[model samples]
Target chain A: MTAASATVLITHPTGLHARPAVKLTKLAKTFEAAIRLRPDGQEGWIDAKSIVKVMGLKLRSGSRLELAAEGVDAPDAVAQLRALVERNFDENV
Target chain B: MTADTVGIVIVSHSPKVAEGAADMVRAMVGDGVRVACCGGNPAGGLGTDAARILAAIEEVWSPQGVAVLVDLGGAEMNAEMAIEMLDEGRGAQVRVCNAPIVEGAVVAATEASAGSSLDAVCAAAEELCQ
Candidate 1:
């Protein structure tokens, strides 16, 4: 099984705080794939499906993130997550 | 969307605190998990009420189970009393967790929304203190 990955810039003014982190984790739960994320230049990837872990990233606006998903729906998971990031988690900036 | 997941209740001395904590949990878990808030005295004072806690528990009751996150000392006692007020069968499915109200509620709600068992949800909430 191949892993699908994408690099996205955090656009939400507050970054991956509580609200956006919740959105990210909730969306990640919808797919069967295992999702992992890390700051663009960071070394470690954390479980994207865990709200606490996602919030711990403390990503700020303009911080780039690398997301990877592995499983049957890896491609779909990666695409949807990328779209969510691009949409700023649908929150007003 | 109900997947044998545990439910959550927030008990606080102030109504706003409970509601705000519930809001945070809702934001994290979305609409899938059940969450309820119980706060303030019956007279609308800054104190916990057993009746209100009981109502909140009933509001989010589920066969899977319910976890109550409380703030302060009195809140826990009221929460326990509220659980005891339930019928034996229903009461058996409820637990008052020892965790920070806001953080525990969020963690518990997140775990519950993922269809976690009652024990798992409680464990997740309790783990936040570590």
Candidate 2:
């Protein structure tokens, strides 16, 4: 199985709030990877595909995040999730 | 609405509240699962109605099962009444979740869109109550 990881910054004004968290989880579900995330300084990881877990993180704007994935599509999953965070989940309008 | 994904219903005393919760579900989940709302009495004021709730359930009926999120005790009671009014087999596929209405519905809808089972979707919504 392939593995991939990324470090990203939450740049959205509200960080990973409801809409962004939902989008992130939904996008993660499209992948065949088992993905997990942790805040830059946090101790444990949360499932990247679980809306409840993603929202529970309460990640705020400017928070740095660490993501890891393992599976056939791990590399693509990590890359896309990193881009989503960078694009602020496309909320800038 | 995929037959493999669970359905969702939002029940609230106020029409706006139920619709608002349903809107949140739509915004979050993008309609992968069927969702319906029942709010206010037949007169359209702020109140719960079993008949209206029943119609909402049927509106989003899916053999995959449905998980209902209610805003208040009356809404929950009316949802229960609506379920009881259903044929026994169909009623067996529904559950009234005990959780905060908006958040619960949003999370439950996401789980449903993820193709979670009926019981899993209900549990996802109820988890917020703890």
Return the top candidate by TM-score.
2
Q: How do the residues A1-93 of candidate 2 rate in per-residue lDDT, one tens digit apiece?
A: 899999999989888899999889888988989999999988999999878889999998989999999999999999999999999898763
| Model 2's TM-score against the true structure | 0.93
The RMSD of every model to the true structure, in order and in angstroms, is 2.2, 1.6
Docking quality of model 2: it rates as: medium
Backbone N/Cα/C clashes per model? 0, 0
lDDT of 2 by residue, B9-119 (tens): 999999999899898888777868799998888886889999988998988888888899888788888899999999866999999988889999998898888887889
The residue-level lDDT of candidate 2 at A47 comes to 91
Q: Write the per-residue lDDT of candidate 1 for residues A39-69, one digit (tens) a residue.
A: 9988898988777688778899989999999
DockQ, each predicted model: 0.41, 0.65
Candidate 2 chain B: worst-modelled 10 consecutive residues by lDDT: B121-130
Against the reference, the lDDT scores of all candidates come to: 0.87, 0.89
Candidate 2: residue B89 lDDT (0-100): 68
lDDT of 1: 0.87
> In model 1, where do residues sit more than 4 Å from their true spots?
B1-4, B26-29
